[model samples]
Target: MIEDILSINQRPKMDEVEGVLFCLLNMLFYNDQKKTVETEQISIALGKDFVISFQEDAHRDVFDLLRSRLNMSNSKIRQRTADYLLYSMLDLIVDNYFIVMERLGEQIEMVEEEVIRRSNTKSLARINQLRKELIVLKRNLAPVRDLISGIIRSESDLLDDRTTKYFKDVYDHIMQAYDLGENYRDIVTGMQDLYINNVNLKLNEVMKVMAIVTCLLAPATVIGGIFGMNFEVIPYAHHKWGFYFAVGCMLIIPIWMLWVFRRRGWF
Candidate 1:
C-alpha cells in the first residue's frame, strides 16, 4: 500500500498502474500560515485477490483503525474480500472530509468574529487567502465526487455486494462536502461585505471630522483675509488694537463653533 505522499517541493513519479479497478483520491493539504491548499493524491488499484495503494510518503492516515482491525485475527475485514479493503480506504477518505471541514468551520467563525469587531489589512489578507484555499479545495474535490458517484452507478464486479452500502455512505459524505463548500462560499462573501462596510464607515467618520474642522476655521480665514486687504480704508487694519481684535475673533469663532457642535451632538 502507498503511504503518505510527499508534497510538491520534489515528489517522485508514481508507478504505472496495470489493473481492472483504479481509484484516485486527491485530498486537500492545507498550510496554516500561508493558508494554502495543495492536492495530495492517493492511488489505489484493486484486483480479484489483492489491493495495491500508492501514496507520497510514510505518514500515518485515517486507515490506522483499519490497520488495527487487520491486526486482530478474527476481524470482519479479514473474513471479507479484498474489495472490502478498497471500500474501507474510500470510506476513510470521505470521513476525512468532515474532519478537514470542521477545522475550516472553526477558522471561518474566528474570521467572521474578527471581521465584525475590527478589521485591518492583515485580516483582509487572511480572509482573501482563506477564500482562495476554499476555491482550490472545491476545484480538486469535485472530480473525486464525480468519480465516486460514477463508481456507485456503474455495474462493476470490482465492487462487491457487501461493500456497496459502504460506498453509498461515502457518497453521502461527498454530498455533505458540497454543502459545506457552498456554506463557506456564502460566509466568505459576507466577510467581504463586512470588510467593505467597515472601511466605508471609517472613511465617513474621517470626512465628518474634516468637515467639522473646516467649518470651525472658515470664519477665521474670512476675518484674516478681510483684515489683510490692500485697501486704504481698512477699519481693523489701521486700529492700534487691530492685531489683538483679529486674534480674538479667530479664537472666539472656533470656540463658538465647538460649543454649537457639542450642543448639536455633531462631535
Candidate 2:
C-alpha cells in the first residue's frame, strides 16, 4: 500500500488488512500561480487508536482546519475516536473538491460566454482546453466515489458505527461532485457543437456576399462583351456618346441593383 502511494497515476481505492482501514485517494487542488489543477496522492490509515495520513507534497495540504479542530479541547473531533478523525480528514478532502469545482466552473462559464458572443479560433482552443481539464477532474473523482462507497460498506472493526454517518455524509458530497463533473462534460460538448455551427454560419455569410458581388458585375460583363465584338457595323458604334453611354449603364445598373437589394433588405 505504501508502494502504491509512491507510484504514478494511482487510482483511488480502499482496502482492509486485519483490523486496519486503508484509503488511497487522488486529491485535486488549484494552483493559483500556474492557473491549473494539480493532483496529489493521499494515503490514509485508520487503526484502533490512531489515524495516520501520508501526503505527497509536504508544503501543501487541506488539513489546517482538521489540525485546528484537533487542538480544541471541546471539539467533537477531540472527543471522538480515531474513526472520526479519519472521517474528518476525508471530509476535508471532499470539501476541497467543491472549491476546485467552483474555480473550474467560473472558467467554464467564461469560455461558454466566449463561444456564444463571437467564437473564433481562440474560443475553440479555450473550449478544448476546458474539456480536457474537466476530463481530468472526472477521472480523479469517479474512482473516489467508488472508494467512499466501499468504505461505507466495509466490515472493518476500526470504523465506529457512530462515525459511519459522517462517512455517509462524505459519500453524498462525492456523489454530488461526480454529478457536477458529468454536467460540465455535457455543457462542454454543447459548446463544441455551437462553435462549429458558428464557424459554418460565418462561412455562409462570406459566400452570400461573394454571390451578390458576382450578380452585380454580371450586367457590366454582358454589355462590355456585346460592345467589344469585332463587326464592321453595329448599332450606336459610331455615336459620339457611345463610350459615355456604356460607362453610364455600367455604373447605373450596379447602383440600381444596390437600391433594389437595399429596399428588399437582402444584404
Candidate No. with top TM-score: 2
lDDT of each: 0.76, 0.89
Query: lDDT per residue, candidate 1, 1-267, as tens digits?
Result: 233233332221212234457676665555566556655667777787888776665593567888999999999899999878888888887777677777677788989899888988877987997798788767755766776776777567767877878778887888888888889989998899899999999999999999998998898899989987889899868789999999999999899989998999987
lDDT of 2 at 15: 90
| lDDT: worst 10-residue window of model 2 | 26-35
What C-alpha lDDT does candidate 2 achieve relative to the native structure?
Answer: 0.89
Displacement of the residue 72 alpha carbon in candidate 1, Å: 1.4
Per-prediction count of colliding residue pairs? Answer: 7, 0
In terms of TM-score, how similar is model 2 to the real structure? Answer: 0.93
Q: Candidate 2, residues 113-200: lDDT per residue as tens digits?
A: 9989999999998888888888889888999899889989987888888888988999999999999989988999999999999999
Best by lDDT: 2
- Taking every candidate in turn, the Cα RMSD to the unseen true structure, in Å, is 4.3, 1.7
Candidate 2, residue 165: Cα displacement in angstroms equals 1.5
Error of 1 at 75 (Å): 1.6
